[model samples]
Target: MKAVGVIVEYNPFHNGHKYHLDETKRKTNPDCTIAVMSGNFLQRGEPALVSKWARTKMALEAGIDLVIELPYAFATQKAENFANGAISLLSALHCEEVCFGSENGTIDDFTSTVSFMKKNQQAYDHTTRQYLKEGYSYPKSASLAYSSLANHDTYVDLSKPNNILGYHYVKAIHDQKSSLKAETIMRTSAGYHDERFSHESIASATSIRKALFSAERDIKEIQNYLPQSTTKWLSAYFEEYKLFHRWEEYFTLLKYKLLTSSPSELANIYEAEEGIENRLLAFISESTSFQDFMEKIKTKRYTWTRLQRLCVHILTNTTKDQLKKINENPVATYIRLLGMSQKGQRFLNHVKKDVEIPILSKATGFSDDLFTLDQKAAQTYLAIFPEPLRTQLLRQEYAKPPIRFNEEQQIYL
Candidate 1:
């Protein structure tokens, strides 16, 4: 069966996500659509607004055939590594195509950039290092190098976050020589950072989260941009318990981690960089909040988001050595199922024996280090919740079955 893959966060499944899913299915006409979604923590180095299970349920309800968790390490890394990990999983799943939403890009555009990068890799590397030596951040240096080598305006086009991610996805596929077709659905509405609901059925997830978490608690505004499935589940979820999580909520623990840890220890965390440990130590004493700490350490060589991820690495005790060890192993030893539809179950059964990695529906009986890290991530996520609820949610990760939804299947709503 033909299957299309998508790498998603779906922090809270919004109207725009629904539109993308619809367009992807229409374009590919795949027998199944599979997703590798971030769990608990997101690429932005912040806690998700809701649990991964809730988001997986949203994806399955809104038409995804299968949802698999993108383990914490890759999900929270920079775009290049993130794309590599996601595409690696899709390739392992034997997907024929991978579709992503790009604001102003076509498949040819991404393919050309990938080809250009591969052809001019040596010059690109030299130029990038020169810029980094001159103190430009890795992202800025790489963009400048690519534009220079390509001898065109590829830089401006690739500077956009979504387009850049799309480029990385195509590049990953190209590097692996995987037979996965890359497709892009042009974004038709609100921009990525737009903090307001837009006309028609489109709205950025950023806007939805902001509106929901604002002081006034604009429930109607949020409702307007969410699909019926998301709205129904999310509304009930909100009424029953708190449904918002922010980086600020964990700042205290992060602060303590930084203050107590020695410079040598801080330097060993993933993405800590050459001199960042000293900068972090200097700022930890003076900065009052996470934002303030980020501002004090931010430089042309390190963007705030990069620094934020490093902080999360520190908080999670994800060391550089540990990351290296994990990377040295095969790319995803296990694919953890999150949720699926009846069609998805059939798809899994069809490919189960042929799949490259172990397909796990539950976390128990797993001794994989990567899997252990995923559980650790869940533990950190649960730490933010209140006492009894925290314990309850922690148990749910191991005990909860992969949510299955179908016309004939009887399951909890």
Candidate 2:
């Protein structure tokens, strides 16, 4: 059966996501759709507003056939790495195509940009460093360099959060030389960071998040956009668990790790370059709050977002060597089932023997292939959960309740 894949972070599934899924199905007409999604934490270095299981259920209810967890190591990373991880997973699942949302909605433009970056690697690298030396953030530096090469200001605009990420997705697919076809749907009305939820059909995830936490946000206001299953899951999860409100709790540990570790050790962490270890140590002593710490270390060469991701990597013990190794040997050797429909189960059985990766439904014990970093990351990720919720996470495997998509499916409203 033909299948299409999506890489997503349905932090709290909303109307926009529903539309993307519907459009993807309409365009690809795949026999099934699979989503490789972020778990617990997102690429932005923040805890998900809801649990992975809840988000997986929301996907299944919203028409996704299978939901598999994207390992935290890959999920909370920069654009290139994030795309590499997600695309590798999708390719492993034998997906024939990938559908994503982009503001430009032109596959040709994305391909052109990727091709330019590839062919002019030396010139691009030099220009990028030149821009960094001129006091621009890494994102700005890269943007300026690309813009200079393109002889147009448009490349600079493409550096905006979503477009940069979209470009990375295209690049990853091309670099891997995968058979998966790429298609994009134009993002309408709202931009990624828009704070208002005025758009009736295309409200941004940021706006939905704000509305979800606002005192004035009523069920009626959200009911029109969210599926009943999503609302039900949110209601239950929110009542039992409190989302992370601060990044300060992990500060001391992070500081200790930085100060005690040698430059050689820090060199192993992703994005650790030139004398950044010293700067990281200097800021940790005075800066408070995740945002403040990021600002203090922000150089013209590195954006705040990039620095924040670096900090998260350090805190989580993800080393540069580890990232490099993973990238060099990018493959999804195992699938950790988050949630799936009955049809998904049948589908799993059909591909079980043929799939290259081990498909895991239960999280009882760790396998040899599971790295020390993965285990450590899993432990750190689970530390934020409260009591019974925390304990429940450990034993959740015993009660593997699969979602039944055939009965729970809903069309876009």
Which of the numbered candidates is closest to the native, going by highest TM-score?
Answer: 1
Candidate 2 weakest lDDT stretch, 10 residues: 404-413
Top candidate, metric lDDT: 1
Give per-residue CA lDDT, model 2, range 155-215, as digits (tens). 4146566667778888888878888888877777778778887766667777777787677
Model 1, span 54-152: residue lDDT tens: 788788878998999898878888898788889888988888999999975578878877777777789989999999999999999988877776644
TM-score, structure 2 vs. true: 0.86
Displacement of the residue 25 alpha carbon in candidate 1, Å: 0.7
Hey, what RMSD does candidate 1 come out at? 2.2
How many residue pairs in model 2 have overlapping backbones?
3
Once superposed on the true structure, which residue ranges of model 1 sit more than 4 Å away at CA?
Answer: 151-156, 196-200, 328-330, 407-413
User: What TM-score does each of the candidates earn?
Assistant: 0.93, 0.86
